[model samples]
Target: MKTDELDYTLPDELIAQEPTPKRSESRLLVLDRDAGTLTEDVFSGVGKYFESGDCLALNDTRVIRARLKAEKLTGGKLEIFLLRELGLGEWEALVRPSSRTKPGSKVVIGESVNATILEPTQAGRRRVVFEDGDVLSILQSNGEIPLPPYIQRKAKESIDTGRYQTVYARAYGAVAAPTAGLHFTKGLLAELKEKGLSTTTLTLHVGYGTFKPIQVDKIDAHVVDPEDFVFTKESASALNEVRKNGNRVISVGTTSTRVLETQYIDGEYRTGAGLTQCYIYPPYSFHGVDTLITNFHLPKSSLLALVYAFGGTELVREAYAYAVENKFRFYSYGDAMLIL
Candidate 1:
């Protein structure tokens, strides 16, 4: 199908610029897959859907401070946004001052660190190879938090660095937060456990792929950038137990869903840790992830396409229509939808 066909209009005012004071206080729009119905509630009410014995899968990929500012020897300023780690001192990145940075130009980030712009990579991204003895050390000492462009605030603010992350972030690799996980709170998890709802965690280092625009006319031509992910045998075993018990295996975000599905090889789930470039769109079958909890996504993006796949295309279209008309929030810090 044409990518444009999936696009919809979202008012600029509806994009949430800052996170709410309390993560669990955001609005929740409940959408039933079977009945094709919509309901409104608070995010804290989400725990009510899963009774005792149900399992919720969460992504624990920690967001790294990936934004960096460097100066060229020519006295030109360059903004470097690290997209993902490609190993061997190489990284996929988006370079500002692209015009000034030629293939051979060296951008010095600090006294002991620099980057050389290599050949251009796919999707207008550049291959920037780092020249640091310790890449992670250099980034930790100089890099800034990589906030999404939609938020019209300074990423240097204390709240930006703190509030942009989830309480459960553990594996430090993601450039962006799996925002759907942002709505969860420590108290909520404690309550879920106290009520006997099982929980499991995996890691999917979110890359720019989650936000990459649909450039192709036909959605079929679009591909994704590989992101680092990990699914251990313990989590897989817990999920299999849930499946055997006939309880719901609810995914908290697309990151968790992708990792779970990536670990699914034949007809069963396995344990593995590596990179996955799984591109999910509508009219596709989902082997894992029975239900989903996600935030409102941008029009025509692959994320929205996944939502369309889980909740039928017509259901997603109708729900998005209602959300727009009803002035619901959209994007990173926006409202959420629970598909059951």
Candidate 2:
């Protein structure tokens, strides 16, 4: 498949700059994969389509304040976007004005947070070690939420801290949120529980690379960045039991879908922690997920490619067209789509 096949025209106004006031109030677009049908509904109605025994897999990774602004000893302004943690005080991050921040250069954030750039890595990433302290606490005081570039507004630190994250976010490592899970609220989860539907969680620390566009014309030639994920023994057993009991396994987002597909080996899910670079596109055979709940994706992105792979290309294109025509919001903080 050609990468161009995934491209679509989206009006600038359609990109959502902020989340809906209430999590469950966002619109839901339901796509019937087998029937090639599309329906519009509210996100709160998500439980209505699932059976009693279905299992919904959700990513519980938390978004950290990865975007930090600092100043060089020489007084040049610098930006550091943390991508992955390497150790207690070390991380791999993207540094702005990379040419100026060389190995051994020091950048200071506020009065106490200081870092030394160690070396350059692939994808313009820099290895940096910070002065030891409670890193999360330091970030809370000195960093800002790394909103997507297309949002087109300055971060409102007080508000985005809560809005950009999901209600169930537990593990703290993700630079980006598993956006599809954003529409779920505590009330909705309890409602699904009452309906006899259960949920299992896995963690995939969403990296900024999730937004990386497919550079190759041939879809097969595109490469994805490896992201950290963990599938515990408990989650593995729950998912396997869902399959054993003949229940559907619905994945909450592409992040969860990637982890599920990556861990599936031979005939079952493998439990443990590992790095995955699995890329899903058209003509791909899905081994774990029966249904997918995801947000609309950017054009020519690997995310859109995976959506086209799960739901047929034409169907997804039509659904996107419908979203545009009806003025449904797009991207992170956008409305959701359920592929069933």
Candidate 3:
């Protein structure tokens, strides 16, 4: 299918610059896949759709302060966005001015931290290793919460540093938050627990690839970069048990759904750690996920296409149109939708 088929025009004002004062206060657009209908509702009404004994899975990967600003010894400023850690403190990252600095170039941030470029990734990304020390601490002090380029906000104010993360975030590794999960609050989680809803975690350190726009005219021609994911034995065991008992597997975000679906096939669970480049489009058969809780996605995006695949294509299109007309927030740090 033509990538242009996925395009939709969004007004500039509709994009949320900041989060609502309360996480659960955001709007919820419930899309009933079975009924092929959409309804506007409050986010707190999320639990109304589910009864007791259902499993809701969340992506627990935490977002790091991954955007770093550094300069070459020649004092030229450069921006580095951490993508994926290769191992031994080496990471694949997006580099500005990558054209100027080739292999063996040195970069220093502020006065204390620095790194060396080992090489470049296939997509012109850099393979960089920080000067020996704790990379996380260095970023914590120097970097800011890396918002997507489309977001108009410039400075990472003290407020965003906290709001960008979900209350359930743990296992720190992500460059971006599992945005759909962002709408969930600690109070809401406690309520779900009390209501007899169980939750499992599958970590996918959300890399830039998940958000990078698909450029191919034919969606099938596009290639999605592999992102790291870990599904532990405990989580997998619990998920299989849920399926066996005919319970719902409610995926909290596209990240969890993509990785979980890849590992779950033929009614059996494969507990493992690996990278997945699974791209879901129309006609894709979902094996594990029963319901998906996700945020409104951007047009011409693979994420949106995946949703159309899960809930029929026409159903997603109508849901998105309804969301736009009803003033529901959009994108990362935006409102959410529960598809059942």
Candidate 4:
């Protein structure tokens, strides 16, 4: 498949700059893949479409405050975006002005927190170690939320610290939030539970690579960076039971979908932790996740390609056109779509 096949026209204004006043207030676009149908409704009412004997799998990976500002030893300003933990006190990061901060360069963040660039790694990333108090605590005091670059706005007040995270977020590792899950509120989740809809949680630490645009002309040529996914034996057993009972496995976000599709084995969901670079594009046969709930992805992204694979290319394109026509929000702080 060609990368341009996933392209769609979206007005600059439709790219949401801020989240909705309420989490569940965002719009939901429902797309019937087989029927080629589209419907618009409030996200809080998503449970209306799913009945009993269905499972909603959610990504519970927590987003850390990963963006750090500091000064280089020579007094140059530096910005480091933490990607993932390499070990205790060590992390993989992307540094701005990478040319200046070569291996062995030192940077000081805040009053006492200092970091040393160990070496350059794959994809222009740097391995850095912090010599300070607990890295997590230091980040809480000095680091800022690593919002997607497309947002182009800073998190306002202190509430953003909480707003940027999903209500069900628990495991800590992700650099980015699973935006589709952002539409869910505790009340809405409880309501679904009351409807006899079972739910399970998995963890995929979304990396900064999620924001990287596809550079290859051919979609198949694009290689994804590996991200860690945690699928416990309990969660797998629950999902397998859902299948055994003749129910649908509804993935809450693309991250969860990737974990499901990648970890799914011979008629059973696999258990334990693993890394996935599973690239789902058009003409791909899905083994798991009968339904998907996802946000409006950016054009020419691997995410959009995955959507094109799940929902037909033309169908997704038409739905996106309708979204643009109806003024549905776009991107991370945007509205959602349910592909069934």
Sort the candidates on TM-score, descending order: 2, 4, 3, 1
Write one digit per residue (lDDT tens) for candidate 1, span 1-340. 7899789998899999888889999999889988889999999989888878889899998888888898987778888888877777788888887766888778889676878888778766788888764667778888898888777777756576777788899887888899998998999889888888989998999997788888899888988778888889999999989988888899998888888888877867799988898888878899898889999998878888888888888888888999899988888888899999
lDDT of each: 0.86, 0.93, 0.85, 0.91
Clashing pairs in 4: none
The per-candidate count of clashes, in order, stands at 0, 0, 0, 0
Candidate scoring better on lDDT of 1 and 3? 1
- What does the lDDT come to for candidate 4? 0.91
Q: Write the per-residue lDDT of candidate 4 for residues 1-340, one digit (tens) a residue.
A: 8888877788899999889999999999999987879999999989999989899999999999899998988789989999988888999999998878879998999987889987889888999899863788988889899888888788765656777899999988888999999999999999999999999999999999999889989999999889999999999999999999999999999999999998898878989697899889989899888999999998999999999989888899999999999999999999999998
Per-residue lDDT tens digits for candidate 3, residues 1-340, read 7788788777877888888899899998888977878888888879888867798889999988889988887668788888888886788888898898878778997677879877887889889998765788887788878887668877567778778888888877788888998888888988988898999898888988877788988888888888889988999999999888888889999999998888896677778888899899987989879999999888888998889888888888888887778777789868898899
The numbered model that scores best in lDDT is 2
Quote model 3's TM-score.
0.97
lDDT for position 237 in model 4: 95
Instruction: Check candidate 1 and list the clashing pairs.
Output: none
Quote the positional error of residue 155 for candidate 2 in Å: 1.5
For residue 309, model 4's alpha carbon misses the true position, in angstroms, by: 0.8
Off by over 4 Å in 2: none
TM-score for candidate 2, residues paired by index: 0.98
TM-scores of the candidates are: 0.94, 0.98, 0.97, 0.97
